[model samples]
Target: MSAPFDLARQRFLTRCTVVSLPKPSPGAPPPSVVYYMHRDCRVQDNWAMVRASQLAREHSVPLKVFYPLFPSFGNMSSRQYSFQLAGLAAVEAELRELRVAFHLDHSSPPAAAVPAFAAAHGAIAVVTDHLPLRLLRSTNAAVAAELDALPGPVPLIQVDAANVVPVWEASGKREVGARTLRPKIGKLYGRFLTQFPPVPKMPAGSPLPPPTDWSAARAALKVAQVPDAPGLTAGTAAGMAHFRGFCETRLKKYAAVRNDPNEDAQSGMSPWVRFGQVGFQRLALDARKLGKHGEGVAAFIEEGVVRRELSDNFCFYNEEYDNLKGAAGWARESLELHNKDKREYTYTLAQFEKGETHDDLWNAAQLQLVGEGRMHGFMRMYWAKKILEWTESAEQALEWGLLLNDKYAMDGSCPNGYVGVAWSVMGTHDMGWKERDVFGKIRFMNYAGCKRKFQIEPFVSRYPPAAENCRKAGGEVALAPGVKAGKKKQKKA
Candidate 1:
């Protein structure tokens, strides 16, 4: 007899492409199932959890959630670590309440840690979340291979639960830009945008395994490696509170002041979004319900939902997302033509990391990221473009930008970050502007240009200079030769 599957269950299963396993080796342990990848750390509105639960009920097997803590994954810093751990602590608490076992295993690579945990728990299959980043991709593949080679056949399921429209459903081919993807996303928006019903109530099952120790987890973290940032509170409760505050006050003016560095008009939800403390679907639905008739609501939704999801579509479909080699043909050609152009000033990776750039505005932007784990969305573009002008090559600029971004920005390690870097450094998903040196015809941003547009003094004043020497050597510093320094330092001491 086959297992009973409902309409909702069948609909979700059909969306995910399944990989068939080869026949098991004789005398091998039978496959035990579990979930291993992508921290979709929410209990409610998570397709991965829902699907995993359905399978568990059908098979009458114990289900568990496995998260591996790999410190060496990337340039993760103290700030990022604190934010992730805080959110996971909340998730662990939520999972305990749901009566599902949550396990945290420390290992160098998740592939090794996950399978071992599954085996210990007597899992028959493994369901993991799909992530577009190379590190996670390789980790998932490694785990799948390990399971394949096991003595018994273990089915591995990869779930696409991050985006509103699954990456495959959005587009099979890489989209050209927002314009191309916007319409395609719009046509199907109504279909997939519905709220995910709660994970179907299960009968009283075995109590969860021992909960992870939050205090020990904190003590064990390598604090020296992570960056320090302020104004960020971790966990789902805090995330929801922040979202509510944004919708109440900032959403009204988001359209008008989202670009202003000084105004807190933007939804400060990226940290939460990054860790899945709050799923994108929940936020989108709440925003839609709250701002049904207003332009502010519409604009915020466009950016938060439509545009942001489009980023996932880009990274998921394109392997070259991490490099300039993946840029549009015109952008690549233009950059190469200007490769020989003399740079006004060049800085090394160390100098850039230390915030030693000659441009005060640029340094201020960098300080914001280092100090707060974020910079204004508008400033991030200017931030990357300036790096292009001041570096030896576009490739070098990309490297520095991504390192600084992922290391400092709490919202780093996301498709949006990759897309932002590509758009600024290589002109992917963007159109060229008037020709300029170093940047060629690609879009350019300069300190003087920004100064002309806003109250530079106040914006600069927000972040004081990092170094005492830089502060003592006051007065506006010129980024290019022959330009005059202002009497007042761009930022206060």
Candidate 2:
């Protein structure tokens, strides 16, 4: 007989995508279950882990957690890996408390490591978290094929622990925008947002795996750490602390000052949420339980659940998420129409990387990313638009923006970042704004426009631009109304 809590969890597995392979022949040994952990890194409040445990108990077999380390896993930087491994350390300990075995290997690729390990270890089923990114999606397919080619059969299950409303469940096809996706999520999240059952106690007296040497694991990473995000720590505890701090200080003012780059009023949960240290559902539930935040709570949900899931929906259904190819036909047409238009100034990727752009505000945004491994959310759109303005083509702009974003933002190389860059450069979910040179019908934002929204001078002063390193080019050739690139007035082309 299974515990009632485990029963509830087992029922929840119905929400996951499960594929059952051919069952083993008669007189075969009972196979253990393995969860090939990837995206989500938490133990408590983790759906996939709970489902894996339930399946293992159903078969009266052992359950294990397996993590594969590849530096090139997602083009992650040292800072990204540092935050991930730190949170993972907490997961290992928490799982030990639950008596679930945790296994991590510095294997070349998960496609080979995961299936090979399951086959050699006599596993019955392999469970994993859902990921929509191109590389991860392809890797998952490869792993599934590898496992299927083995002896009898190995069932593969994928759980979407990332979103409160699973990406697929939210929508069948790519969503048009938040408005299209919001209604469905609003109707569905409540069902999936039930209280998470506590981690089940594994079989008593089961021999535990050896402790993971987190230090050695960090040292072995192929990615190199740059500067860490100041004052931010990794793990579930840290994530909780940050959430509480938001509720106390910023939640009430979130809608008001969230767009102001000068104020630190955002939730700041992306780093932890990106690494799965804190579940989006968990955050939503806790924030509501606190009964605080006044009106801003709805604003947070709109961004965290609706917009976040919309990013996943875009990535999962659309293959060209990282570039202009994924843009709406209107956007693509608009950019093509303006492609030949002359830009007043252009900057090489290296120059942009050095924060040597002609605009001090743009330079400051870049400096924050390079210096602190994080950037203000509002400035992200402005940063990418400036790249589009200075670059020769939309393709180059997307490439350059992704390069910096994935390299610097603690939560980059993700669906959100990919969709964000696409939103800014390619206009993925956004509709065309006023037509202009370089940007065409896509939205146009300039220094003067940004200054009107926030305290641009304070932000610029906070992170001084590398002026000595700057080599301003294409000066005085172009001028328009409103936009400012130094003393020259930004004018219409």
> Largest TM-score belongs to which candidate?
2
**Winning model by lDDT:** 2
Candidate 1 lDDT for residue 38: 61
lDDT of 2 by residue, 310-415 (tens): 9999998999998778889999999989888898778888889888866767777899898888889989999998899989999999999998998888988899
Candidate 2 runs further than 4 Å off = 1-30, 466-493
TM-score of each: 0.87, 0.90
RMSD (Å) of each candidate, 1 decimal: 5.2, 4.5
Q: Which ten residues in a row have the lowest lDDT in candidate 2?
A: 7-16
Q: For residue 179, give model 1's deviation from the true position in Å.
A: 0.4
Instruction: Give the per-residue lDDT of model 1 (tens digit) for 115-206.
Output: 67765665667887666777877777777677666545465776677776666777778888888888887886777677775664455656
